[model samples]
Target: MSLIDQVLARAAADPGVRGVILTGSRARGTQTARSDFDVTVVVAEQARPWRHSTRTGTLDEVVCTVEALADTSVHWRRYSFRGAKVLLDRLSGGIAELVDRQATLTAEEAVPLARANLDAYINQLYRCVKSRRDGLADAALLDEQESLPWLLETVFALHGRLRPYNKYLRWELENFPLPDPWSVVLMPDQVRLAPLCLFPAVESLARRRGHADVLDGWGSDIELIRAFAGAAGP
Candidate 1:
C-alpha cells in the first residue's frame, strides 16, 4: 500500500482515532518531491504520539479532541483543516463537516475582523510615518513590517475572503485578488508604497459598508503622508 493508505489503515483501526485528514501542500496538490505528509488525526479526548518513518517520508500528525475542534476559539487548527482532504471519518459527531465549515467566514464575522484589521493598519501606518519623520529608519522599517499583514488582513476581510498562509499569498492574489487598485499595491515588495495605494480604496470600501467611523480621518492621514513624501495628495 502507499504511504497514505497505510497511514489511513492504521488510523481506521484505532478506537480513539475519530477522524483522519490530510493537510498542507500534499493535500492541496501543490506538493514538491520533498514535501512531507501533514496528517491530522482527531481523537475523542486525549492526544497521542505522532507516527512517522523516514522510509515513507514524514507523517506530521496532530491529535486533537472533538471538543477542541468544535470550539470557535481554536482557530489556527481549524484554519489548517480548511484545505485539508479527509481520508477516514468514523466519528458520529460530524467532525469532518465542522472542518469544512471553517473554510469561509460569515458576513457578521468578516465585518468586525475587517474593522479591527483596519484599526491596526491605521495605527501601524501612523507609527511608520512618525518614525520616518523622526529619522528613525530602523523603527520605520519595523513599523512597515507590522503594517503589511494588517493591511492584507483588512483587505481580505473587507472582501469576505480568508487570508491564505504567507506561502500561498502570491498564488491567492494571482487567482483571487482583493479588488482593483488595492491588489496592485498589496505586493510583498511594495510594502512602503501600500498606504499611498491603499487609502482611497479603503476609504471607499468603508463608506460602502457603512464603516465610515472605523476609517475616520484616514483621508487626511493619507494626505499628510503623501505631502511628507513629496507626492501629490489625492
Candidate 2:
C-alpha cells in the first residue's frame, strides 16, 4: 500500500486515535508529485508519543486533542483545515462538523474581516497611486503588489468566505468564482490590470454590507482613488 494508505490504516487501528484528518494540498486534490501527506491525529489526551508531531517518510503528522483542534479553528490557522478530509471520525461526525466550521465564516465574522481587508487594500492602493504619480516607480510597484492579496481577501469576505491561502488562490477562484463583476476582475488576465477600477466596486459592496462608515474613514483618499481611476478611463 502507499505511504498515506498505510498511515491512515494505522491511525484507524489505534484505539487512542479518535480521529484522522487529511489537510493541505493533498486534501484539496491539488497535490503535486512532491506533495507530502499532511495528517492530523486526534487523541483524548496529550500523552507521550501521541503528543509530538512527526515528519517522516512522506507523512507529516500532527497529534492533538479535540479541544486543541477546536481552539485552532477560531484563529487564522483555521484555514489550514478549510478542505480537510476526515479519514476517521470516532467522535460521531464531530470531525466533519469542525471541518465545515473551519472552511467558512459567519456574517458577523465576515463583516469585520471584510472591513479590515478593505482598509488594508485601500491603504496599499492609495500608496501605489500616490507613488506612481510622484515618480517613485519601485515603491509604486511594491504597493501595487501588496494590494492585490488584500483586495482578494476583501472580495472573499464580501462573499462571507475565508480567503484561501496564496497557493490555492487560483484554484479557489477557478472552482468557486465570486459573484459577477468581482470575479471578472479577479480572473488571472485582469487581476494585474486596472486595480483602480476595483475601488468603486469595493466601496459599493462594502456600503451595501453596512461598511459605509469605514469607507468614510478614508476621507479624501477615496476621492483621490476615484479621480485616479477616472483619469485612467474605462
> Across residues 77-161, which tens digit of lDDT does each residue of candidate 2 receive?
6778877899899999997887777676888888888989999988888998898789998998788788887888898898999
lDDT assessment of candidate 2: 0.80
Steric clash pairs (candidate 2): none
Cα lDDT of model 1 overall? Answer: 0.70
Alpha-carbon error at 92 in model 1, in Å?
7.1
Writing each residue's lDDT as its tens digit, candidate 1 over 146-223 gives 877787778888888776777666656766667776566665555445553455566577678877887665657765
State in Å the error of residue 93, model 1: 9.3
The candidate scoring highest on TM-score is 2
